[model samples]
Target: MRIRKKRSLLNQAAGGDGLRRVVRKAYGVFRREGLAGIKTRIAWLRAGAPGTVDPRRYGEWVRCFDQIDDATRAVIRERVANFENPPRISVVMPVYNPNPQWLAQAIESIRAQLYPHWELCIADDVSTDPAIRPLLDRHASADARIKVAFREKNGHISAASNTALGLATGAWVALFDHDDVLPEHALYCVADAIQRNPEIRMIYSDEDKIDESGKRREPYFKCDWNPDLFLSQNMFSHLGVFQKDLLDEVGGFREGYEGSQDYDLALRCAERAGGGAIHHIPRVLYHWRVHAESTASGTDAKPYAVVAGERALNDHLDRTGIRGTAEFELNGYRVRYALPDPAPLVSLIIPTRNEPELVRECIKSIVDKTTYRNFEIIVVDSGSGDPATLGSIASLEHDEVVRVLRDDRPFNFSAWCNSAIEASNGDIVGLIDNGIEVITPGWLSEMVSIALQPGVGAVGAKVLYPNDTVQHAGFALGLLGMAGRVHHHLPRGSFGYFGRASLRCTVSAVSAACMIVRKSVYRDTAGLNEKDTSMAFSDVDFCIRVREAGYRNVWTPYAELYHHESATRRDDSDLAMQARFDKEVQYMRTRWGSLLRDDPFYSPNLTFDEENFGLAWPPRVGALV
Candidate 1:
């Protein structure tokens, strides 16, 4: 005869009192059957009988029973008797037509781990292979930590990942894939990182790519934990241990990102994480399988990967409220900002001695191309004896937009700038050389954005030579005898050693040729030092004071301008220019001392060897060609 378990306690009650009889009946049922039989009977009873209990609470109880077996129950009771905590972890893997041998290898890798405090939850999309079920069963039988759930229907990678994530139960969740191999120390590394930095929400490490025969590949893209690079590209290996709370907060892996889910996750995590919350392990703990089907192979085969990357970038910008246009082309890989609505007031200060044509071109460009609306021009005439230079300033049709300040005391660039600043009413102060010609629209917007960042004291533009070669990418002091030198002269498109068109580095000073400074910093710095005002070392001195006061001086390649070198100060006698240059170098050497002598960016060896000034500046020969 087929035996059926009681569907409800009320039906098995032996007495009239419902509560007391229910307890007695439960005890009798447990006594009559073995643990497995009782579990089967309980499963049947719950299926057949409905309860009015809260669904959430009842579901929790159901999950507890589902995870428990006869041996586990006894162990739990013993642990409770002895007062011990249970080990918990949630291993989430999303599979799509996974190879049986590779899947088995992945499972075996998990089984071989020293820390056996984990559970494996696999979300398998529908596959046509007949060997999958038997293979899964063979592994599941060997270990209770392994659990497999086959979807009734086929889902994409994102949906499959979410399905696996839904089954997590541990305090932490680990992301794993079907074909990847984890080192024996993988779990231990994660545990150690988490233990050290408990406040960190996620941890990732470097990974090696192995071929089909398990041979390591050449030229690996080593993982970097830089947040800036992370936003631009996926520099972190994906197999990371994430806190369950942070995972839930981000709503798990976003769908529709077929191959770039990890990239998307890294960007989102960086956006939400506070300072230093995301961490990196400098060792390779995960082995990525580099087969033909891998996403990193190329975008041609997996076009969706490129799409996903673009989508991730767009989403990051949208979420962060960063307003700029993203350009991904060669020589144009930068985000240029559109002019802000009701643009902030700017005061354009130009110190002129006797350059009429260049100053007129500069003013015309500002009036013609500048999309920014509110701004005034302050021309500090530092003893311009040329009648045409004075006439150009007097010839402005809009006199209301232009103000001329006469400086008859001396030709001090610093003091002239101070006079201009005193005459200006704008919050942002721009100092442009009389020899510069603005070449781009929205140049002011780009400058303003960098200056507006907290703690940023100044922003300078990318000044190019009249021959179209880069003149000054940015300025770095102590680089070449404490004199500020331009960064990239590499034949147009080279990224140089810094891996950027405009390299980001801490500099002793930026040039005052075309720079933007906040009004408050100008006030604080006392408007530059006039002690050495033959225009010799004033910019360097100002930048030093700015840094000493704890402010960052930035150089951006976003704003482009053409510099007519030394148009106002005619030191055309090569000896005079050389003498002036030597004096400035001497001043820097005396001020900075051993710091200038030890700069890595400068090279005495190349300076002696190379005739090319370009190669001599960077100290590395043949790198810029």
Candidate 2:
């Protein structure tokens, strides 16, 4: 019945004339592998999970922002004229048996660039297609900027890419594919980013897929430089431009990673990005041609790509000295960083009121299920009046691992957490809500491992509701003013927007309901805010402070827990509570100022109206420049 319902959803989602073939294939998956298989299969078939977005929304967005009128082109021309000494950008392409039409289009896109400072360096890997050489020659003859080299031997993509690299004389190199089409302003944007940030070592832009009919869709409007997210999947694959010196230092793309050679190269470059040398342009600069054979169409087309990506990530993990295991799952990689030898004692603090069952569930789940051995629990009871709740608290006081702190203060969550934090002596401190029940036994192991990372400030678990729907994957700024629930209500095990829900990536914030951080980090940030955001938005404020203190706040789905609290059905009807909530929202608006509006973890192209990565009706980006 679940399989039938999922198939129905897939069939319904696979609407429009273009996805009919995918729907037919999806039925086969339902018969063979059941619900999980069909879910993953449909994702490949649809190119992405079917979010609550109109299918033609990307097309509309492109028409509004990507398309350039004569007036806009004139403006771009004038801006180009005012540019400084622009560095020569070498657009390197490795050709090997590409479609005649696509190869032609790719070359034409380079020639059509608005910026005139780029050189197209093409290396053919002994194409068996008889007509390929003439086409390359024709383009090479047509434009002096276009350089072509016919390889004597049939070297793979990595070898061919190095050959193209050998031909580059420019200080900056842009990795271009033989078949993908670049926008007219693609090189212009790269050049613009380079000129603006002279110290920038690498730059990449958002990209989309183009089918055989030239219609574009699946625009991946990505966020700024996210090192953790990059480790999960190659977010910097399209319009990937790197300073030649960095490439020379890193020794470019490696062999045997043909399909994900670019991913490998980016991972290598990232190690030396010097914290802020990488940049992301929030625009679709490249159009990945999707066909039966292209990876843009599906990962199954080249299963070796997934294997290569897994190996590449592992290679990176090994090089970086991170004690972790990388495994490929759901078209992305999951890295389980090992807990340090003699795992540091973790202090779990839970603040509860009159809820006895919720408290018992949270405590028992942890006591029974948590695999991380060295941990102590502190339950901060703030005026529990119910007899049953008091009895439950009295029973817990006798437990060796658990301690009760009685705080009869007016319900200030920050005060309770801070009070408990002060009383704890563990290296790592966990802020668990009374209603948060452990779903996975290794939840503490995952959180503690991530928290111990020197650069990480806070680690959050994948929080789910009672019915197994996502309560909070992570929190982002400017969503519903202060804190927005990311991937809210998405089903368990589903990939949300290129693995946003599933991937262990950095975010603006995580819910304190199931968050962990080093005690030192808590001390560094002065703990949660109690004065302004005493009750609400304190976690968000604390996270912001943590990030500002030069630490990344990460959210991972591997650490799963059930948030049994009625977060969605909060009845803040009291006049004082409502007034306090309003004040907290205003406090964030003033305290953070521009930071709230410009969350680096989220794209400006995305809407703040909701947290689902929806297209902003009028995107926050300025007119094409």
Most accurate candidate by lDDT = 2
What would the per-residue lDDT of candidate 1 be over residues 74-135, giving only the tens digit for each residue?
Answer: 54344334423433557788877677778887888788654566788888887678888778
TM per prediction: 0.59, 0.91
Which pairs clash (backbone N, Cα, C closer than 3 Å) in model 2?
Answer: none
Q: Give each prediction's root-mean-square deviation over alpha carbons.
A: 22.6, 6.2
Clashes of each: 0, 0
Give the candidate number with the greatest TM-score. 2
Q: Candidate 2 on 6-58: residue-level lDDT in tens?
A: 34433443343315634555564455334645554444434445453464878
